[model samples]
Target: MAKQSTLDKNILHFLGPKHWLTWLGMGIAYALSFLPWFIQKFLGKALGNLHRALSPNRRHICDVNLHMCYPEMTIKERQSLTKAHFESMGIGVFEMFATWFQDRSKTISKVSFHNEDVVEKALSKGKGCIIIGAHFSSIDLCGTHMARYIDVHPIYKLQRNPVMNWVMERQRRKIFSKTIERRNVREVIKSLKQNKAVWYAVDQDYGRKNSVFAPFYGHECATISHISRLAKSTQAAILLYDYGRTEKGYFLSLTELEDYPTGDEVQDATKINQLIEQQIEPKKAQYFWSHRRFKTQAIEGTPSPYSK
Candidate 1:
């Protein structure tokens, strides 16, 4: 833990009037994180409702995504799912704060690992394990718990808000074995060569550069087509890391992909995408739907599905 004096020095940069909202938000998150788990759930749902009411654009994005992905769902069912997703997002906020502020043991105690042996077997190989994850509502928070089972390095993207980004990085640095930037491919490869586990999230559209159109939820979505090459280059085991809430609590596990990286980029991308789609089906609402996932059309000049 950082000393109070050091934390105070860190907060000095955000004392200006423009950063008041960030300061207030951080204070609220800090307080909420320490609340009882049950109370946090209730308050998180309420906050989700409030956020849904306030953000039409984001809500619409979710609505569009849900519709495109699950056309079989009736309008009412989709609407309900959308609202529930927002609630999950709201709860995720609490989880994020708790993850950053609470003890590692507290978060680890709350989660159940379904298949740690899978991870162990992968690590048993001389090569490191390449753990690919999707955009779950509480990835970083729950991922911190999953790390208890395996010493996994997480690659994080920088938040646009520098203040919040700094705060998150500080906390993340403490809990994680090592933190790498999402774009730092060289470091990721080097870590794998060192027989270290790295949790790299690959379920988002990073645009056309080094990406290909792959089937995501039955639609052709832009996906990065480098996992196979990455695996081959690093001689690492490829595993899909999955975590979600269930009737019990949060369940997290790793599924090893055997004989992977057939050395076909498109085929490899499709296989990974299919696995993600199947995994996300049960925890539909917990998946991140607010992102403009299909913003980059597979067909050049085609309009984005999320367009108003």
Candidate 2:
């Protein structure tokens, strides 16, 4: 057998008594996975309410985003939307639980696919596909559920908590056809060449590198630009895979973009932001509003609108 390295020993040490609370939280989430759908929804909203009450800074970030994006919205309307965002976020947590412990067949049977012909056509092109994913509520569950329909490889990030990271990797591997590290450009290209759909969330800002400052929701926001490169190199089609929750279960939509990667990076990025807005408009609260979306301003040295 291979000898465990020093880093492995330290991981074992930290995963022991040093992380009791983390373990307890994971345990509770696991146990909650078996609750009936209706009850789980109630408890999830309650948990979200509790979290909203405790997290003022996060709430402030959401408020700032709403003010920027929905300048026309009444303060009352924005406040209501904030509450719904948190509640949906809480319910999203339990959705992860449902995905981890519940029966995949039964859970997926509840999902309805729309405009699936879009994907059918995209795959028919013989080039790979890059799914324009987003950070929406129930992100974990939605990403996992998506693989059921298409042979998708999710571009994943490592959880900050090492112990939880292991858990996430294990769970993703179980549901996803394959998991690709967010930085593994080679694997992404290879998968696309194989005509497999790769899920890529281009909404987040990862500093200025390979990113362009563009107007998103009426604010100058940093947008990832390498997507244009990826699509160009792989000759892969870019499709939007939108997820929505109804009273029954969930629904996903596959939308094929026309005239994308116009060979202009900024134009393509702007189009992405535009498409994301369309996706969020119908389900405002189901989107992740608490993220510091405008952290990186358009101009260098410009102060972030969000409070520290």
Candidate 3:
């Protein structure tokens, strides 16, 4: 918790004319928060279409990612998937509002879970559980909702904008037992030692240091080895936490990775990537294809596939 004086300073700083755009954006978010669900979704669709028109570079990134991951798909099919992905990302924006502003009880009530006992059984081991999250668009809501069921400690990267970071941190504090900074390994390990559920997103390209080249969607990806290291150090159980939005509601799934960490970091990373791949296979569009997941190359001096 920050001191009242610091918070006051931030509020005063954010009130300056230079931050008018931030204020306007936040105001729109607040206004959309009260709108009907269907109307909000309609606006999200419009936002998606606008993004597709204005963000050609991001669209190109998504196109390249989808093409590489799904080489068997036709060009038309990949484009369709890319468009749907932007829509999902747009919906995710509204979902961020629902998550940070909507009633916590209502949010938790809507999540229907399968194999929830898997989480309980893993926690029963008394070693804590590492909930491995991917870049699924539904994660913003699902991460917060999971806290209602378990004592969650989510690892987050700090936003570059100070005000934005403060706002998000304030909201996340309401759900997570403790929000761990991504760089603070000691705190993360300490949380695990206390038998707390620590959530981490493993599907990212973090370069060579502390990462290994592993197969993701049959392509070599620079996968982080920290999760495997954490599991090994704490003797904690690793569980894949995934969710999808259906016509009914959000379907959250928890599956324990059997015989994980195998004492081989690279092999464990590959297994983690495989698990994430399986989860997104059924709903490819929901996965975040806009990110440069294959940014890092396995071989030195090999040009990035996404580079122009």
Candidate 4:
């Protein structure tokens, strides 16, 4: 493990500064996205033309997810949706940069909040709740906006680029100073004890030893057990939050999980996982399907639905 850490550090050092790349990419994308309505329309049409000509990996990811989640979808319908998904992903990339680089008012105006009472109620109890978030549309802004109403401690997996990490750390701290690394389990526990809300993006590919197989999109996938463990230890209420894009703009919604900490850890985790799936199902195109979510397989001799 020490050797692996050293290798990782060396690789990051080799990459050197990444802040310049981030700035250049973000600046160009934001400017393009904010062009005049007529100009932006032309640019969008041109991009659509290019999209039809090129075969992006995002298309494949969308197709795979659609196939897995909606086996009943006809191939033609799936293809059409996959095309729209890639276009949306492209637009979302630019929207992400615009949100990150632009002023808070401009970005926050694009998102609407719903069921804020859920968070207020949790905080009112003075025990702080665990917010389980996923990488859906405009997810980063969810934490940013929530911070305006209450203190939110979000967990992030640091990047390899030291310079880029420093830049992002500064930007993130502007809204949330209590950012914890994924490996800092002790720190997370301490924060919960202090009655601080901790936000976690639980839908990711954690290896077998650290995660348990859970059903997602009708397939068994390795899901993080940390949230369940923390809830069991601290008795914190579990709430799921997601941001979905609307025709007008973006909107945030919170769903409170029923019967949290019912003395069945696995069952509790399964329920939370199902709630996350339910949230993602309606906004399938916005979900980050590029991630290899089912990288870890079920144990040998078990019927693995996700074996690809």
Candidate 5:
């Protein structure tokens, strides 16, 4: 075996004691997974409520997002939504455990697909597919089930925790057709040109250079324009890929775009944002509100929504 680097040794030392807590939580989640589905769900709801109470910083972020997006709603209404979102997020943590370690067969059985034929039809053409993925709390679980149906090459970021990162990558490799690093633009384009399905999420704010200030829920949020470039360059189809967590399980779908890559980057980006809004509208609490979505302001001197 190769010798461990000093950094590796240090990471191991730091993680040695603390890692057990994560492992213990994983154990608890796994145990709960075997129980009746409703019971496990109840446990997740309880856990989420506890987390919402304890995690003030995250709750604050959610509050900011909800307030900005739903300006018409009363503070009380937003608070209620935030509470429910946290509960969904709490259950999502358990869902991650289920995606990574639960019986693949058992979890896979729970997922249902809608309008998947759209993806198949797109791929049937010579041009590849760009699956416009979004951040929902149960994204990992959704991706796992979606991979069972299509050979989706998902874009992912490296985990900060080295051991956990390795585990995550390994689990993804086992499930998805292929996993692409978020920064690998070349691979993404190549996959698209080769007529493969590449899943990409452009909702997060990545600052000024590569993004444009686009309207998302009436707010000028920084949205990536690279997706437009990719579509134009490869002439690939843009399909909306998102999942909703129902009382029974997850409902994942792929909705094809009619006139995307309209040769106007901002317009295409706006259309993408609109599609995302449509998906998140009905299931507001199910969407991933924990992210600092409006961090990058369109105005030069405006305050960031996330600035405390």
Candidate 6:
């Protein structure tokens, strides 16, 4: 954990003002979202053109993810999907700014919910539940919508930009007072004990020691152990929540993972990984393919070209 913290600190230092660039980009994106529907649509289309012109390294990451998850897809099919993926990414960028900048009531009104009873049931149990989500199409909006039903304490990895981080923290704190840092395990556990729902994006690559290798899209990747440990320790019900984009905007789907493994740590973590993959399979384009998901590979062999 100490090593991972050091690594994150170093990476943050290296990235430096790149975080400000993201905020600047987001500022433009947020303004674009409020444009006329036709204008927003046109901007989305233009993003596809820019994505197509990406250099080899950037394009390779997208290509590798597509090939790995959809091995049966022909090159043409994969390329088409990749383009669509970029278009969605562009839209998502704009959506994030819209979500953060817009009024909470307006943003929440744009999203609908299904199977909210699943959450109600978990809360009724008197033990706070862990809501496991991923980098799906409208993940940011999911947290906003969820705030209407329950107090969601989301753990976020702080960004490098002091100014932007201040803005984001203020925005999120409007809905969740318990927005703890990812490294603060103690605070997370305390929130769970208080029966407060906690949200986590467990799909990211947490280096070797902190994570165990688990199968995701037929590849063994490092999976975070915190979810399993938290669930077992606090006796918290685990729920899978994903946001799917629709013509109207976004909708949240909540499912109870009653079948989550509990005995063996390795098997338990793998079960969670599989559940995430299953949820994402139907909405492959919604998943964040641009992320380095397979950064840490299993031993005994090299990672496939598609890995990460």
User: Each prediction's Cα RMSD?
Assistant: 3.8, 3.5, 2.9, 4.5, 3.8, 4.6
lDDT of each: 0.84, 0.84, 0.82, 0.68, 0.81, 0.75
Q: lDDT of model 1 at residue 16?
A: 90
- C-alpha displacement of 60 in model 1, angstroms? 1.0
lDDT of 6 at 44: 64
Where in model 2 is the C-alpha error above 4 Å? 1-14
Model 3 earns a TM-score of 0.94
Between candidates 1 and 3, the lDDT winner: 1
Model 3 stretches with alpha carbons more than 4 Å out: 1-10
- Expressed as tens digits, the lDDT of each residue in 1-308 for candidate 5 is 22222222433553577577765665676677677667767877888899889988889999999888888999899989998998888788778777777766887667899997898799988799988867888887788888888888998877665556655776677787678888888888888877899998778888888798779999888999988888787889888887879877789888888887888878887888998999898789988898889887888779887788
> Relative to the unseen true structure, what is the C-alpha lDDT of residue 156 in candidate 5, on a scale of 0 to 100?
83
Query: In model 4, which residue pairs have backbone atoms overlapping below 3 Å?
Result: none
RMSD of 1: 3.8
lDDT of 1 at 28: 82
Instruction: Quote each prediction's TM-score.
Output: 0.94, 0.93, 0.94, 0.81, 0.90, 0.85
Return the TM-score for candidate 2, rounded to 2 decimals: 0.93
C-alpha displacement of 61 in model 1, angstroms?
A: 1.0
lDDT of 4 by residue, 105-172 (tens): 75666678889899877767667788887887456555667777667788888766554455456567
lDDT of 4 at 116: 85
Ten-residue segment with the worst summed lDDT in candidate 2? 1-10
Model 6 — TM-score against the truth?
A: 0.85
Q: Report the lDDT tens digits of candidate 1 across residue range 1-308.
A: 22221223466765799878987889888988899889998998999999999999999999999989988889999889989999999989888888888886775666888888887788788799889979988786778787777888888877776568768878987887788887789989888878889888898888999698988888898998877888888789988888987756788888888768887788888899988888888899999999888889889999999888
Which residue window of length 10 is worst by lDDT in model 4?
1-10
